[model samples]
Target: MLENKVALVTGAGRGIGREMALMMAAHGAKVVVNDPGVSLEGKDETDGPANEVVRDIKAAGGDAVADYGSVSDSASAKAMVTRAMDTFGKIDVVVNNAGILRDVIFHKMTDEDWDSVIKVHLYGSYYVSRAAAEHFRKQESGTFVHMTSTSGLVGNPGQANYSAAKMGIIGLSKSLALDMAKFNVRSNCISPFAWSRMIGSIPNTPDQEERLKSLRMLTPDKIAPVAVFLASDDSKEVNGQIFAVRGNEVFLMSQPRPLRSVHRSEGWTPETLRDHMLPTLKPSFIPLHMSRDVFSWTPV
Candidate 1:
């Protein structure tokens, strides 16, 4: 579906990024596998996952190249994009799949942890997307697939840093979708619950793993096709949306709820607040899908 298109994927050395790069290549895109060969905590290593994916792509008769640039660094991100242009002359898709997890409670989360997670996930997407947007604008057509997380949507304990970064991508994707609409550049975010090194360490028994495997709910490959669709012409009209992909289930998430006024007329008194505000302030819940009557107080 992506014949003659050039695609760049960060964190493509292994896991979902690797699968996404391979899937795009299999669909006829000339892929650029960008991975810093890092661990889950952003520590650098000498692994060749990026090179290996490129080799796999070439072995499958698809075009691919390897890039060991860190997506968090502006210069490295620029270089990665430059490599795609240098290798294929034009960039048609960019997958910001590079991310890191620094799990910690709000009290225990240090400044370093917060900054590092933000740098890798939030700023990484920003740097890479900004660099690619220039090229996509020139072409007047491009796709940006950002790898977000369910943790961002449903706040997970002990993952404040990670959740904040992931949620920021949602906002960034939405704004970019609107800003780049005129240029035919589509931006979308995907929250994938896949079995990767990041999730492997999350206290799971062999039986649990077997059960999940049987259910087919946590494989990285299962998430790749959705990403491929987003990167292909199939999703040309889909923009500013956040999707959750896990096994056979694909969830179209809702936007953040706008603040609502409970009682504006007779406010400010403690007694009035106790009687009126407390009762009137209904829990604002956002529905998963868009509907004509969004403000209805009915249960789904």
Candidate 2:
């Protein structure tokens, strides 16, 4: 589906990003595999991961190039897109799959924790998309596949930074879809339930061992095909959409919508809201549930 196209996949060193890069290349997309091999918390950078992926692609008769650029930096992000153009002459798809985890409860979260996660996930997505936007506009065609998370879409504990960034990506993807539709550019988000290094970082408790086994079933490779479809003309009509990919289940997730509303002719006073609106809206109130709570069933 991606013959002759050029794809830029950030964080292609490993996990989901690596799978996306490989799958896109297998389908004939010249891939710019961008990865500044960093530890899960964004430390200890190396070029080994990116280089290895490039070698694997080449060995498999697929075109690919390694880009050891940190997505957290605006200049580096832009340079990655520029590298695609320089190497392949054009960039058709951008999978903003680069990310880092800084899990801490909201009260204990430090400035660095918040800033680092936001910069890489939210700001990184923006910078790369902005760089590609100019080219997409000039050429009048492009596709963006942003990696989001159920933690953001629903809720999660000790991930204020991650959840906020992922949710912000949803808004970003929606805005890009609306703004770039005229230029034939499409933007969509994927909330993957994949067991990756990121997921491996989560502290596993003896109580949650069984749940961990279920999570392991949802591998990163399962996410690649959905991203490929979103990036291809096959999904030309799919934009501003959110997809949650579990083991064998693909879900079109719900966006925010009014479940119930209450009004008063006199307008709502604090007391009136407390007494009337509270009672009327109580049944419709969404529960303060974590991602696991909502996804209680074993993925298949």
Candidate 3:
């Protein structure tokens, strides 16, 4: 369905990004596989990972090229977009799937921990998207498939930095969608629960071991077709939306909506708010529960 399209997938070396790159290629996109080959914690880099994936695509009779550039850098990200235009002559999709994990409680979270995660997940998405956004706007068309997380959607402890970054992408995606809607450019994000190197590193509680197994069942491949769909013309009218994917399940996440409200023609003081408005609004407060509590079910 994406034939003749060119797609740039960041962090395409491994995990979900790899699957997305492969799937996009199999569906006839000339894929640009951009991976700096960093470990989960954002340390070290290599060339082999990106090259291996590029090789796999070629072996499968798909067209692809390896890009060893960090998405956290705008110049490098622009280079990825340039590679696509130079290689395939036009860009159709850009998937910001590259990310790193630095799990630590807020109390113990260092400047480095917070900064690194933000640099990768948040700024990485931004720099890459910004680079592609310019191109998309100029061309009057393009698609952005960004990666968000359940940690950000619901609330996960010990991932303040990661969650904050992921959630920030949701806001960014919405703004981009609104800003680019006039240009026929669409932007969307996916909160994927998949077993990858990043999720595997999280220290699961004893009760979560079985949940981890379920995560394994919801592998990265399950999330790839969704990327392809958003990138293709199939999602022409879909924009500024957040979706959650697990196994065979695809959920449309609740957008921020009004739960309750109160008004006083005479206006109100903190005293009035505390005595009346707070109580009126308390019943509608959404509880912050971990996704596991919400999405637990038999896996496909």
Candidate 4:
């Protein structure tokens, strides 16, 4: 599906990113596998992960190159795109899959904890996308597949930083789709429910044991097909959208839309809002629930 295309997949060292890179290559995409080998908390960088994935792709008769650059830095992020163009002559697709976890309760979260996660997930996504925009505009075609999360789409505790970043990515993807549609540039997001090093870092309790067991069944490879589909011409009609991929289930997630509303034609004060508007809107209020609470069923 991706013959003669060039794709840049960040965090392609392992897990979901690695799966997407390999799968894209198998489908005839020349892949730029970008990974700095950072730990779950975004430290301890190494080049081994990126190099290994490149070797694996080459061994399978697929073309690929390693890029050991931090996506959080503007120059480094741009370098990844530059590498793709320099090596393959052009970049047709970009997958913003690089991320790190600094899981902490909102009350106890430190500046560094919040900033690090935001830097890697949100800023990293923006920097890379902006760099590629110029080329995509000139070429008149490109695709972006961003890795979002249910934690952001629904809700999750002890992940203020991560959740905020992921939600920001969704907004970024939507705006990109709207702003660049004239140039035939497309952007979409994937909320993946998979077990990886990032998932393993989440705070676990006795209550989550069964849920964790179910999560273990959702391997990262299951999410790759969605990425491949979004990157190829098959998804040309898909943009500014979000899809959630579970074990064997693929869900088209809904975006923000008004469920209910109450208005006072006379423009009443706070008293009217508290008595009339509250009652009218209360019936349509969304429940305060975590991501797991909303997806309570076992993985299919």
TM-score of each: 0.89, 0.99, 0.97, 0.99
Candidate 3 residues lying further than 4 Å off, grouped into runs, are none
Q: What ranges in model 1 sit over 4 Å off?
A: 203-217, 259-261, 266-271, 283-300
Which ten residues in a row are the worst by lDDT in model 3?
291-300
Summarize candidate 1's per-residue lDDT along 1-300 as a digit string, tens digits.
Answer: 889999999999999998999999999999999998988888888659998999999999999999999988999999999999999999999999998887776898799999998999999999999999999998899999998876778765677788889889998999899999999999999988677888765444465555445434467998899999999998888999998876777889888675676656645898877877777765554444312122222211
* Model 3 residue-pair collision total: 0
Worst lDDT run of 10 residues, candidate 1, spans: 290-299
**lDDT by candidate, in order shown:** 0.85, 0.94, 0.90, 0.95
Residues 1-300 of candidate 2: C-alpha lDDT, one tens digit per residue:
999999999999999999999999999999999999999999976889999999999999999999998888889999999999999999999999999999988999999999999999999999999999999999999999999999999998899999999999999999999999999999999999999999999766698899999999889999999999998999999999999999889999999998988878978789998999998999988999988889999988
* Candidate 4 per-residue C-alpha lDDT over 1-300 given as tens digits, one digit per residue, 9 for 90 to 100: 999999999999999999999999999999999999989888886889999999999999999999999999999999999999999999999999999998888999999999999999999999999999999999999999999998999999999999999999999999999999999999999999999999998989998998999999999999999999999999999999999999999999999998987777889789998999888889888898999888899987
- Evaluation by lDDT, superior candidate among 1 and 3: 3
Ranking by TM-score: 4, 2, 3, 1
Clash pairs for candidate 2: none
